[model samples]
Target: MSAQNTQSGKNDKVDDVSGIETTGHEWDGIQELNNPLPRWWLWCFYLTIIWGIGYSVAYPAWPLINGATEGLLGYSTRGEVAQDIDEFREASAARDAQLASADLDTLRENEDLFRYAVSSGGSVFRNNCSQCHGSGAAGAKGYPNLLDDDWLWGGSMEDIAYTVRHGIRNDVDDDARYSEMPAFGELLEKEEITALVEHVRSLSGEEFDAAVAAPGAELYADNCSSCHGDAGLGDRDQGAPNLADAIWLYGGDREALTDTITNARFGVMPPWGTRLTEAQVQAVSAYVHQLGGGEEPAN
Candidate 1:
């Protein structure tokens, strides 16, 4: 009998032995319904099961005395990873060479090169800066926004390079840029601090006592003006905050402002120059510049 005829005969005999009748051709009160599994599908399923058994035996599927079973084929996930990294390096050699050779400004002019830097730098930012700056680079209180063009230190490629090389408040750094916003807690009484807070708050049009602000004016010049500037516009070189701006690192609330004055807040940004290569630092700065709201500063 042909294969088809043999299968049909076996199916026909199944109904009688199983005590099931065929829908049309019943045998011994046994019915064989029209439902039948495809031969190819069943075979494939069996083959996959057999393959799985063989794979489990040959591969590192089971844990042993010291480690997992080393596959007979000697396939290793770590080896595969290393191989992938080598492939990546080989593929990106041209780009890496360009980055190494080119200045940050020159690289930024090339959109493709800039994009490559952003992708590479994004990984580094996520690993390091994301803790304070957030995954989106939106800063928490006291931490400045990386997305914005506004930088306490200058935003130029060279400027960023300098800041990253020598961190603010990084005392361990021999060449660290240092500025201390004197604590007003000892200088001013509780009521006087409240007046200054009200005055600072009024700069942004938040609720404040005008009468108290008048008195606070003199105090601002005496203590804060040395760094924050006469107009309260801030001195970027000194890393002094612009009290006039709507953007507040700490909360703009009266209590927060009062606290800030009482015990001056110093925000510290870690230097990346020590940890990362020059090219890597440049890439990160470029990526940060691409974050929304950043713009080229006037020469």
Candidate 2:
């Protein structure tokens, strides 16, 4: 060590105590060792750098001004997904064709088709209708509950299919089940609106003021009877809801009823015919029908 230090350059320092070469730099009392890297470790690092270069050249890499670089192999995630979708559609072509043309009234006679429709409809409902109607199909405020017997429109399988295809109060379809309630805010006084609220409460068997409800009987007869009927049984032909049933799309309370009488409800549903395929519309309609609210076609 002492002989090597004598032969070393002026820049190379030697530690006095250990008689070993130093890097001519120290931190406090310690000096760093300038040892050569292990040959195996160095080779492994070089291989990794080579692999990275090769991977970049052989695969999608390097973002350009317009798009990403395409490799020689020309693989794409979108192309792969599209191929898988095409294959799936081809496999189900027979079933889809049968479903698209099947009659809703007789579709249930074939157990296999019925089961397929129900399952497929459930998937469609979750994907499209669940945002408004709820995941469980229980519905929310202003969205009618599907699990109950009460229905604004007829709930027969055919009726449901028509509704799903054309929708309610939608402007896109000419045959959409159309109905409009005159907004009574300008037509009736505040007291009349309040009376109507109390009367509606009474019709639903809720607690109400008999005095206010008495005046509302005449008011309801004159204004609401045309659509809602004398007993508030609701006319499905006009899409009028049963006020006596207590089940409401919106709340059945005083505040909700008052607002409804004053402004009137103008709920709109988009025609799914424009968006979903015919089979999907029928499937989703069938899905909603079997949710326990479906009714038999009128004899």
Candidate 3:
């Protein structure tokens, strides 16, 4: 009977128990039941396709030859960020102007301004000056230690500001602090230089050969005393470093001293006047002055 029904085109079957229709197509006599999708699920799938098309049309979604497509809204995240940065710089301009105009003396009187300068200067130092002066500004072999009272130029606020702006022995600035120490290796005999090194070492209370240093004292008086002073108390005007102090810029070791005398040490610091704004120079100077090494300004 099933075969007669199938041959008579009545094979479109229904499950009598469930009352559901089955697809007429069958494989190995196993027919497939036809099921309709839920209405809510179909609606959700259609809505997503519409949302995607709308989003592509409104925002930058397409690629072009030179750039991305400018969508209907014409909005950009980068443009918004640039605008925000511009606004921030504009807001800070007035404060920056005030800082630039204020002198070191005036800045010190205003506690708020002083604090601001120090904070801002710290950031500037870390970014720009930390490469040579270390992150803590403790200095290295040739760099001067900023935490100590020994300043090759001067440790006063004004002096520090000047040095920072003009720099030392840098050719970039015409008015840069300039000084030169003659390489004594060419002028003096090796024995004489050796004696001078001993003399310099003895000035700092280091043990030295008395016989060698005695003759070295005469040489120092004739050659170094004019700038370094008779007592080795460095002259700021001449930029001569003090030999009497334990703080050494290069090193206090025998080899370091011998090299310095033989070749002469000429450490160069680059001028910040052209690189940094006036406010930044002032701020950094103030920050350095407050670092427990600054001296009272000479009256």
Give the winner by TM-score: 2
Clashing pairs in model 3, backbone N/Cα/C closer than 3 A: none
What TM-score, to 2 decimals, does candidate 2 have? 0.86
| Model 3, span 68-141: residue lDDT tens | 98789988999999999899769867877888998786678998888989998998899889899999999999
Which candidate gets the maximum lDDT versus the true structure? 3
Give the root-mean-square deviation of each candidate in angstroms: 7.7, 3.8, 8.0
Cα lDDT, model 1, residue 178: 69
Model 2 per-residue lDDT tens digits across residues 183-294: 9998999999999989989998999999989999999999999999999999999999999988988898899988898899999988888889888887887889889998
Model 2 error, position 144 (Å): 1.9
- Using lDDT as the measure, name the better of candidate 1 and candidate 3: 3
Q: List TM-scores for all candidates, in order.
A: 0.73, 0.86, 0.75
**Better-scoring candidate (TM-score), 2 or 3:** 2
Badly placed stretches (over 4 Å) of model 1 are: 1-57, 61-69, 295-298
Candidate 1 lDDT score at position 164: 64
58 Cα displacement, candidate 1 (Å)? 3.1
